[model samples]
Target: MITTVTLNAAIDKTYVLSDFQLGKVSRIGQIHAVAGGKGINAARVLHQLGIRTLATGFVGGSNGDFILKNLDQQQISHDFVKVDDESRICLNIMNASNGESTELLEKGPLITEQQLAEFRQKIVLLGQQSRIVIFSGSIPAGLSTSVYAELIEALRKTNAAVFLDTSGDGLIHGLKAAPFFMKPNEDEIAQLTGKRPENETELVQSLHQLADSGIECASVSLGASGSMTVYKGTIYRVRVPSIEALNPVGSGDAYVAGMAAGIYQELPIEDCLRLAAACGTANALSAHAGFVKREDVDAFLKQIEIVQL
Candidate 1:
């Protein structure tokens, strides 16, 4: 079974408008609210793929009740530590005409030491039975940057593989623990490596450098250009063919979910990237997070071009 941890979960609200103007009233075309957090999103996708998943994290207050109810409505199993403060809400405003998106995210509830300790205990117990433990998203305030590293270390002792998807300090800290795989976008790669890549060759080289530092597998997401994955001294680039993009939000999460699923299923690395790209492309067809369909992934997987780099 796959276990996903979302330390900072939220109620995600997405609004669609034909033309968004500042200092003016605009009617919203559509609005959506769902369980929001990287790990939860991955678990949702994984569940839809027919994988057994358990989501764990910290949540509290009436907002926490809403999250719990929503997960129950979706029939997703979860275990969360109750906290004092209310969980956050994230706002995504999508431009209907231009296919553009703007995100307004709120910092999540501050976790107390006692509550965090309980959360860790729950994860340690879950680790004993989980095959793949995915540590994703941000660490809320009051948690050390090395929190994920610490979690990975615990999961390692239990013989569960770790897949980390985070950025900046979280990425650096998690790398020290040497996760089985990591999915960082280009901007995150720049932040970690200091030197930025101007092209795909340079980016592959940088990915190699990161792998040299002890990371087992690394994939740098290049947005519309698709993504590049480096594993076992070989570099593979999966290019996303041009399509009428409806929404780009959650594509990276879909990619991570695909990669995690592939790793869990013991598929080839190239196949993993193909599934990753396919999931991402499927995500672009819908505005909701974790909205990719199995049929869409199957269809897109056939068209993805994977090149040796």
Candidate 2:
């Protein structure tokens, strides 16, 4: 079993418009709402790939009710702890005319100390049974940046591999726990290393330097340019063939899902990168978050190229 922890989950709502103009009336072509947060997104993708996943986190109020129902409709198993505060709603507005997207995110409900203790207990129990325990997304209000570090430490007795995906202080603090894998962008990588890479050469070098800190694998997202990763003391560059992307949101989460799936399956490092990139590309080609038709993944899997650098 795989356990995903989303400290802050939301009712992710996406709106599509031919042209989204500020201070002007524009008709929306479509709207969709689903359970969301980085961990939730990854769990959805994992479920789509036929992986057994249990999503655990804090949820509350009517908004939390909506999230649970959405998960039930999708047949995804979730074990969320209810709280007094309401969960958040995240909005994604896409403008087809400009090929741009604007996001309005909500800082989720603050968690009480008692709620934090309850959630931490859940994490330790779940981690013991899970093969991979993924901790993703931003830390909500009323929580310190070191919260993940503490949670990770609590699960240190378990054999599950930890996958940490976060930015800023969350990522920095979580490092002390030494996650098995980490996926950070270029800027976040620089922030950690305290040096800005001048070019791709420096970027790859930075990735190598990070691995030296005891992180087994470090994968860096390069957006449309694909990604670079270090695994088993080898550096590789991943590239995906071109495809018209309807919506690129959640691609990163999809990538994490694929990587986790690969790790769970004990695939080769190259195959891991191949699967990860394939899922990310498939997500970009979809109109929704955390969804990729199996056929689409199969078709795109062939176009992905992986090379050791």
Candidate 3:
């Protein structure tokens, strides 16, 4: 089974408006809310892909209750550590006419040291049962940047391979644990290597540098342009066909889910990249975050082109 970690889970609400103008009282056309956070989003995608996934993290209060209920309604399994503080609520205001989205994020509840310890113990047990343990998203307010690194090190005792998807210092510190796989976008890649890649050539070079640092696999997401991935000392460029994107919020998480699913099935590197790209593209076509129909993935898979770089 795959285990996903979401330390700062939240209820993601998307408000669709005909004309979302700032400083104006706009009428909401529609609203969609779901259990979210990078890992939860990925878990939801994994579940849709017929994968056995267990989501674990911190949650609390009415918002947290709503998150759990939503997950239950979706038939997604979860085991979260409850806290006294309320979980966060993130808003995505979508402009229906222009297809543009603006996001307002909240810093989640403060986690006590005791709660953090309990979570670590839980991960140790979950890691033992999981084939792949994914650490995603930001750490909560009270946790240090080294949290993922610490957890990854603890999970090292288990047989599970670690897949990390995060940004900033969390990504920097998590690198110390040498996870098996990581997917960072272009800007994140620049932050890690301290060099802004001018083009795909430079991006491939950055990926190779990451590989040299003991990471088994690394991929740099290029939004609509697709991605560049490196596995087993080889770089592959993934090309995704354009589509009318309804909401692209969780495309990255969907890509991670697809990659993890492929790895769990032990598919070839090329096939894995194809699946990952297809899932990401499929996510853009959907209105919900981290959601994709299996048929959409299959159709997109046939259209994706991967070439060796």
Candidate 4:
């Protein structure tokens, strides 16, 4: 089974409107809400892919309850530590006129020290039962940036392959644990290496730098241009067929889910990239975050091209 960690889980609310004006009232055309946060999103996609997945993280209050209920309704298994504070709500306002999206993110609840300890213990225990443990998204307030590093190190006793998808100091410190895989976008790569890559050559160089630091595989997502991945000193470039994207919010999480599914199945590295890219593209074609139709993935897979670079 694959285990996913979301330190700060949330209720994601998407509002669709014809136009959004600053300091003006706008009538909503539609509203969609779901259990979200990077790991939860990935878990949802994994479940859709027929993978056995368990989501672990911190949640509390009514929003937390809603999150858990939504997961159960979706038939996604989850075990989360209950906190005293309330989970956050993330709002996504989509403008129908020009397909622009505006996001308002909450900082989430503060976790107490006791709560943190409980989660650490729970994750390590779950890690033992998992073949792949994914640590994703942002850490809540009051947690140190080294949280992922500490948890990943604790999981070293288990046989689980760790996949990390996060940003900022979390990514920096998590690298010390040398996770099995990581997918960072261009800005995130720059955040870790302290240099923004200007072109494909520079991007590949950055990936090489990450591999030298002990990470086994690192993929840099290039949005519609597809992605570039480095695995065990070899580089591969992936390209995906373009389509009109309905919503690209959780595409990254979907990508992580596909890669995790591929690795868990012991597929070849090239095949893993193919699946990952397809899942990401499929998510973009859907209106919901972290959602993909199985048929879409299969069709996109045939169109995705991968070249060894």
Q: Encode model 2's per-residue lDDT on 18-70: one tens digit a residue.
A: 88989999888899999999999999999999999999999988999999999
Q: Model 3 over residues 16-76: C-alpha lDDT tens digits? A: 9988899989988899999999999999999999999999999989999999999999999
lDDT of each: 0.86, 0.90, 0.94, 0.94
In order of lDDT, best first, we have 4, 3, 2, 1
Task: Name the regions of candidate 2 deviating beyond 4 angstroms.
Answer: none
TM-score of each: 0.97, 0.97, 0.99, 0.99
Task: Write down the TM-score for model 2.
Answer: 0.97
In every candidate, how many clashes are there? 0, 0, 0, 0
- Residue clash pairs of candidate 4: none
Q: What tens digits encode model 1's per-residue C-alpha lDDT throughout 1-309?
A: 999998988888999999887789988889999997888888888888888999889887888889899999999999888888998888999988788888898889988888878888889899888888988888887888899988888777687888899888988888889898888888888877887899877898899988988877889988788999888878888898787878878788888888888888999888888988988888888788766899989999999999987
Candidate 2 total steric clashes:
0
Q: Give the alpha carbon lDDT tens digit for every residue of 86-183 in model 4.
A: 99999999888888889898999999999999998998899989999999999899999999999999999989999999999999999989999999
Q: What is the C-alpha RMSD of each candidate to the true structure, in Å?
A: 1.2, 1.1, 0.7, 0.7
The segments of candidate 3 whose C-alpha lies over 4 angstroms from its true place after superposition are none
